[model samples]
Target: MRISGPTDRRGVTAPAAGRWSAGRARPRVLFLATSYPVYEGAAEGVFVARLAESLIPFVRVLVLAPCPPAAAKRSPRARGRKRVRVVCLRYAPARLRLLAQGPGGIPASLARRPWLWVLVPALLWAMFVGARRALRGACLLHAHWAVCGAVGGLAARLRGRPVVTTLRGEDVNRAARSFVHRLVLRACVALSSRVVVVSEALAQRVRRLVQAADPIVIPNGVGPEFFELDPPSRGDHFEVLFIGSLIPRKRPDLLVEALRTVPGARLTLLGDGPERPHLESMARAEGLSRRVRFMGQVAPERVLEYLSSAEAVVVSSEREGRPNALLEAMAAGRAVVVSDFDGAAEVVEDGVSGLMFPRGDADALAARLRSLQEDPAMVRRLGQAARARMRSLGLRWEDTAARYARLYEELLSEHGGAAGEDGMERGGRNGAA
Candidate 1:
C-alpha cells in the first residue's frame, strides 16, 4: 500500500540508480488501454499518448489496445488500425466510426444499452487468446480505467506480471450509484496491487467502495511545454467555449441557458453525445443558437488551437475526477467557468484564476459568464493568475510517469511473488457473449 515518493520535494528526475543494460535490453513495460490511442478519442488517448512519451526513455514500450475486429464487419474508418504493429488487441466491431465517436463507448452510454455487454466479453476472450504471451515479457501492466484494468489485471495475473489500475472519472466518480459497475470495479481494485486516482476526492471514494482499495492520488498533469500562456490576441470576440461530451452530466444545456443573460456574446461547444440532438433543439428553442455553435466533435490536435483562439474555457460537468480538458484549457492561459461540483471548486478560485456556479443554476452561471465577457481587463487578470497558479503546482508529464513507476514498484513489494488479488483477473469465468 506504499507509493514511491511525493516527488514535489525531490523534483522531477529519472531513476538514475536503476539503470538498465544498453541497446535492446531496456526494461520492457506494457501499457494497456481497453482502447488505446485509437487515432481519435478523448482523455483516454490523451493520457496514453502523454504516458507513452514519459515512459519511452525509461522503458521499452508496447502499447496494447483494442483495434477493429474484421474489416468487413467494421466501419471503413475503423480500418485505420493497420498503421500500428506494437498494439496487441482488436475487438472493435465493424459498426464503430472510430474510438471517440464510437456509438457506445462511454460508461453512461454503455449503462443505458446493456446489449453491449457482448463486446466486453468478446474483447476479454480475444485479449486472452491473443495477449497472454506478450505479457510474459512485460515488466508491468498499466490500465487506463477499471474495466481496462480488469482486463489487464486478469491477463497479468494469468501471465504472472505486476499490474496497476487507474481510477478514471466515470469509473470512480459515478461508481457509488451503479451496483453492478461497483461490484466489477471493486473486484478490479481489489485485485490490483496498486490503484491510482486523479483527485483526493476520487481516491477516498474508491477506498469506500472496495476492500483494501487504497488508491494513490496523483492529480493529472499537463505538459508545461505544450500549454504555455498565449495571451489573447486583439480583435477576438468575447468568446467562451465549453469543450466536453454532450452528456447530461456535462450540463451543456446550462451553457445554452446561460447565454440568455450574456447579450451579443458568442458561446462554442466542442463535443457530441446522447444529448447533442436535444441540446441543439433547446438552443434553437431559446434562440441562442444564433450565438452558440456546436462543433460536434473535433480532433485533439485542433483542441489547443480552439482554446488558444478563445477568451476562456468553461466547464459544466456535474461530476469530475479532475478533467483533462480543463487543465489543457487552463494551461493554454484561458480562464475557466466551471460548475460548482466539488472537483471543479478544488481547482478554481472565485474571481481569481476562474469562477464556478451552483450545479444546474443557469442564472448564476450566466452572471459569471457575463462578468468575464464584459470586462476584458478582469479576464486578462484572471487568465494570468490561472497560468501562474498552474505553473506553481509542480505538475508535469515526467512527474506523473515517475509516480506511477514508483507505485508499481511498491505494489510489487507488498504483494510479493505469490498469487495476486483474486476477482479482477477472473473475467474469463464471468459469462460471455
Candidate 2:
C-alpha cells in the first residue's frame, strides 16, 4: 500500500509529499497490546496511543487491546483519524473481568487476587481470536508487552506473517522473577522477526534470559504538547509532582515519606491505583495529609498543566524502562528527581540535566527535595538544562515514529515483501479464528 499525504479535516499536516509512490496500497500493521486507552484523552496506555497516531503518516495501524468490563460499553472500536482503528477484545464477563484493569496490569491484578488466574484461558483465547481476525489485512504484527507478544507471536506464526515484539519494563521485570514468565519471554523473542526494547537496561535483561536474542533499543517519546508548555513558575511552596500509577513498583510511598522532611514542600500525586489507600494512610500516619494531595488519574492532555505549575517532578520508581513521565517532565521544563534505576542514567545526568537519588531510599530522596526547596535558582537551571537535553536528543514522537517506520520497512523487505504495497500474501479466513 502506498503512503498518502492527504491531510484530514482536523488540519493535521500530512507527511512530506512524494515520500512514496501512489500506485501501491499502504502496508497495514497490527499493534497488539494489553493496555490501551478506552476513550479519547485517557491516561491509560496513552503512550501506545501516541505512537499509533504518529504512525498514521507512515503505515495503516490497527490496535487490538483488551476491554475492561467496566469500559466495554463506552469503548469505541475506532478512534482518531480513519487511518488508525482501535479494536478492544472482550474476554470475560462484566463482573469477572478484573485481570487487565488494575494498577500494575495483569500481573498485579493476579497478585492482588490470586483467583483471577482462572480467566487466563479466556483472555488468551479472545486475544487469539481478535488477532487472527485483525491480521487478515495486516502486513505484520507489533506486540507491545510480553503477554501481547505471546499471543500475537502465536497468531502471526499461524498466519505466516512476521512479528515484532517490544519488551517494556514490566514484562522483563516479571521474566527476571519467574521461570514461567522467562519461558514465555524466550518464546516471544525467538518467534519474532525483530525484538525491540525500550531501554538498554531492558535489552540487558532480555539478553540474560536468552543469550541468542539481540533486541533493538527504541525509547518511547514525549509529545510536542509537553515541549510546548511554558516554563513553570516558583509557587509559594515547593511543589513536588509525582505522575505515575500509585503502585508499589513506582514507590509513591517513598515520595510521601520523602515529603516528611521537606517542611514546606507540597507533594501532588497525579495518578491512582490499588496503592492509593496505603499511600493515603501513610500520609495520615506521618501527619502529611495537609501537605500531600492525591489527584487521581489526570488526563494525558492536562499533564502539562500540572508540570507547568510544579517546580520539580520526582520519579521514585524502583525499576523503569524510560518512564514517559520523566521524559514529559523534562520536556515541560520541570526539574526532575529520578531514582537511580538501571535505565535512569541514560535519561538524566546527575546534577546536570536532572538530579538522581538512590532507588527506594526515602532519606536520599528527601535530601534531594530539600536541596531543590532551598535553591529555586538551581531548580530553574536544572529544568532548563533538562529541556535542552531532551531537544538535543530529539526525543519527539515524530522521531520515534520515523524509527519504527524504518524498522517496519526493513522487516517487510526481509520477509520477502515490499512496503507501500499489498505486501503480505493473504491466506486466512475473514472471520476470527
TM-score of 1: 0.83
Model 1, residue pairs in steric clash = 67-90, 73-94, 74-94, 75-94, 154-425
lDDT by residue for model 2 over 1-433, one digit each (tens)? 2233454344333453333343444678899988887665456788888888877667767788877765755645344344357777788767787888456788778878999999899999999899987787788899999878888899888888889898889889888899998888988887888999989988998898899899998888888878778877776788999999988899999988888889999999999888999999999999999999999988787887788789989999998888999999999889999999999988899999999999889999999999998998999999999999998887888777777877886787787664323433222211111
Residue 421's lDDT within candidate 2 is 38
lDDT of 1 by residue, 274-313 (tens): 7888888888998877788998777666777777778878
TM-score computed on alpha carbons, candidate 2: 0.91
lDDT of all predictions: 0.66, 0.82
lDDT of 1 at 175: 70
Question: Candidate 1 at 230: error in angstroms?
Answer: 1.6
